[model samples]
Target: MVTVKLLKPYYIKTDEQTVRVVLAYQYFTLLINQRVFQFIPIEEKEIRVSRENGKIENIHDRFAFQNGKTVIYMSLVELISAPNFLNHLHSIAQPYIQSEETKSVTLKEETEQIIKVLEERNLKRMIDQALDERNKVLFDQLVKLL
Candidate 1:
């Protein structure tokens, strides 16, 4: 089983058609078995969402992210079926979805606060697991993200 968590939303960019949200820092993490894969986009971490309902679209079904030398390709279709993903996405996108601005600067502080809180929580959880398993390298790396 895989568990998915969406950690942050950078900001929302509303256009005539596409609404882009540049998820900042380590945007999300995918946990498979006891191992965690934290996704930090070096280039593009694109998620196409429906402007109508805010649910993630299937058009761009696959996304790739790198950690050290390992590159992982994840499917949005799989994520959409993941437990609690829709709810998390809805919560992150709700305010921006309702906003009328092309790009909302108003949520900067709020977004940062959300990111910090989530990042710390995520790191702490992973850190504890690492510590319990005596995985020093993974613990050290996760701590650096803090």
Candidate 2:
């Protein structure tokens, strides 16, 4: 049987890097030297999150550093984990996640507002799938709850 896994938020740490977000799941953003790096799933790099006190030594990255691309050791200046970051990631990721017809115009807005919109869209997709599958219990329950 195919064991499908549900997507959920994750925090992971590697010996070389501390990746807080995984692309195509939630969001990934890295700010280095006043530059912002957003991770998209298509990059196929399989970005992983690292725990606190992680190090980036020996990780070869081309566009992340100003002095050079290949980084040996580095330090983080500041970190922001508010929903606004998530919204920013969502805005950047939406085009890749959704088709043109369903894509919404990007706007500078609050994080809470954007999260609500995303959640609603996800719910609609689930309900639609349940309805299409013709599962009596799931469809009926979701239809009533929704």
Candidate 3:
């Protein structure tokens, strides 16, 4: 499964010679038995602008899956049009992004740990089977020699 989120709005120049507004968004993709599924995990958070100072903010999140791999991302927009854009962005991202003061674990780290455990288990099984076969062959040879 792959997840993606829009960390910020992506502005693209269109053929019409105009800049298009794309909502910062996040999505996720899942693959099972050669089938692929895509979904948007985060709903459209309202874009808020503060009148006190020029600042604008929006949050978009998404995920993606390709070639049996999954990725997640968060989309955030902070325009200087509003005074509190930075503060709002920080407040929203705080739960997802780790701070130096907080001991937070990542999804990649957890996946790696699980993979290491499984690999070790498989390797031990292979070694045991090989040793068993070798012992059987040695015993047969000894019997023949006797």
Candidate lDDT (C-alpha), each = 0.68, 0.40, 0.40
**TM-score winner among the candidates?**
1
For model 1 the TM-score comes to: 0.53
How do the residues 1-146 of candidate 2 rate in per-residue lDDT, one tens digit apiece? 11112222343333423443333433434544444444334323233322332222223422121223433222221121322433443333333342433323333345568888888788788889987897778877776766
Q: After TM-score superposition, what is the CA distance of residue 105 in candidate 1 from its true location, in Å?
A: 25
**After superposition, which runs of candidate 3 have C-alpha atoms over 4 Å from their true positions?**
1-45, 48-80, 97-108, 134-146
Error of 1 at 57 (Å): 3.3
Best by lDDT: 1
- Per-residue CA lDDT of model 1 for 1-146, tens digit only, reads 66775556676677644556565557777675646767766545666566645656554556665556777777767767768766777776676464535245547767989999998898899999999999999999998887
Clashes of 2: 8
Residue by residue across 1-146, what tens digits does model 3's lDDT show? 22222234333222222222333323222333445544333454333433222233333432232333553333343132224535544444334333444433456677889999997776666656656778776555444443
TM-score of each: 0.53, 0.24, 0.28
All candidates: CA RMSD (Å): 24.8, 19.5, 20.1
Clashing pairs in 2: 12-49, 12-50, 13-49, 13-50, 13-51, 18-50, 19-49, 19-50
Query: Cα lDDT for residue 49, model 1?
Result: 67
- Which run of 10 residues does model 2 get worst, by summed lDDT? 71-80
Ranking according to TM-score, highest score first: 1, 3, 2
